[model samples]
Target: MAERKLNGGLKAALEYGPILAFFIGYLQLKDQVISIAGTDYSGFLVVTALFIPLMVLTTGLLWALTGSLSRMQLATVVLVVVFGGLSVWLQDERFFKMKPTMIYLLFAGVLGFGLMRGQSYLRSVMGETLPMRDEGWMILTKRIALFFLALAITNEVIWRSLSTDAWVNFKTFGLTAAMFAFFLSQGRLLQTYGIEKDKV
Candidate 1:
């Protein structure tokens, strides 16, 4: 399939739209309970159920429309199926909640492994759109890897130590805000390295 290069806006929408749907799905079904579970069926399960199909459909739509999918997008769609399915099947929220941690760790691990092997994986994945020198790519990769690791750790803390509702709030709002801040913090670095003009 020919790769249809996505603009930053569409990429952001594709990445975050399903996430926002999760929150909306949760709220829409917050008070409803599934009786089959006999006890633990809750809003979390509803959202998880809604999430699986919604995400799968969204990913399929993206692929059908764009004729391309990124590595990260493909991985995330699979994770959503595995974890989200498990969450609904088991009538437990933990599986769903852990999805973000796993994703963050996976990215961190891949990037860290690349750095260990003396490769800037981010540059390989994003070089055309996010042009940078070797040094800039190295530095950006390190910071992004660390940031991803931090996000994983934070997800662990929030999900493990808080109520399901609180965790959802943190996942939808806190994480989103933090991600925006992280990108903002990299503005000078992006400027220094010079993102591709067409991309910017």
Candidate 2:
């Protein structure tokens, strides 16, 4: 049988599903651990230890079910295993927190380098689905790279300064809302560059 094509909604769900699952699982498990182990148990610490590997497993299952794993997904899995193992072995949450930072910095550096070379990596990723003029793609790439950088900084601040509950809330709802807003704001550009079915 031929593989089914995933629409934007499906793609978004698959991409965010594991993260959402982790958030939910962490909250539930944290409560359970605290309740079972008494007040002495560090719920946050316990959840942090369990979250990464759970997320990685969830993501892998999602990929297998969908039969799709993009380069970004592959990179994410690799990071999860490496950093997650370090987190468990070292008994520290710092490595897990740094994962997003590393991803953002890597993307920023690569995109910045691509821009310098007159290439738009973002365009390469989304070009087929959202065809646009060269200038439009370049603009989109720059904007996206900057957005990722902002998200990275935000994650760092939240993880460092906020309570675990707050960080979890931000990761689940705040970050998702921000991304949704960003996507909606790009509607005008997408419309401008959108190809009609007749044209396609």
Candidate 3:
């Protein structure tokens, strides 16, 4: 799970491509609803369909190139396929919308479980990329676990209270922005914890 930095563009593409694919596919297919069993489907179905294959392809390529994929990436893809397939096949938008919540909650559970076992899953993955003291890793892990839970709650709120398109936008763009901002806000803690940005 220790990954050196990939090329910036490739990193962004690998990370964001599936989300963008969903958003774009939804937009392009908004009017092209596919009918099944005399029922017409809409953007959600198209988005889920596109998102799954794109995620699988991207993650598989990453694993092929790196010879490894983290537990998180594997779980994310699995959830995407499971929930997304349910959404598409069962014609239930809730399944698609719950994907992120499930992913975030899963991560939170993992990180929490790791912490309870006196280990840091984040550190296990990022040890090479972002060296830090054990204490730092512990604190960061707790923070991230909390953040993941918060994100899950937020996703639930947004999906339930807002429109599908709005939720899609949040998934594609808003989440990325929020994560970047949170990362930026952690600069001081990272610096204190022996972050070697220059070397990295």
What is the C-alpha lDDT profile of model 1 across 1-200, one tens digit per residue? 88786677876676778889888888778888767636657877877887788888878878977898878889988998999899887877789899999999999999999999999999878887777778889999999999999999999998998887789889889998998899899989878877566654
| Cα lDDT computed for each candidate against the true fold | 0.86, 0.73, 0.86
Top-scoring candidate (TM-score): 3
Tens digits of per-residue lDDT, candidate 3, 86-166, equal: 998898989989999999999999999999999999998888778888899998999999989999999999999998878
The lDDT of model 3 is 0.86
Check candidate 1 and list the clashing pairs: none
Alpha-carbon runs more than 4 Å astray in model 1: 5-13, 36-40, 195-200
Per-residue alpha-carbon lDDT of model 2 for 25-65, expressed as tens digits? Answer: 77776565444333343455566556666667667666766
lDDT of 1: 0.86
Clash count list over all predictions: 0, 0, 0
**lDDT of model number 2:** 0.73
Q: How many pairs of residues in model 1 come into backbone collision?
A: 0
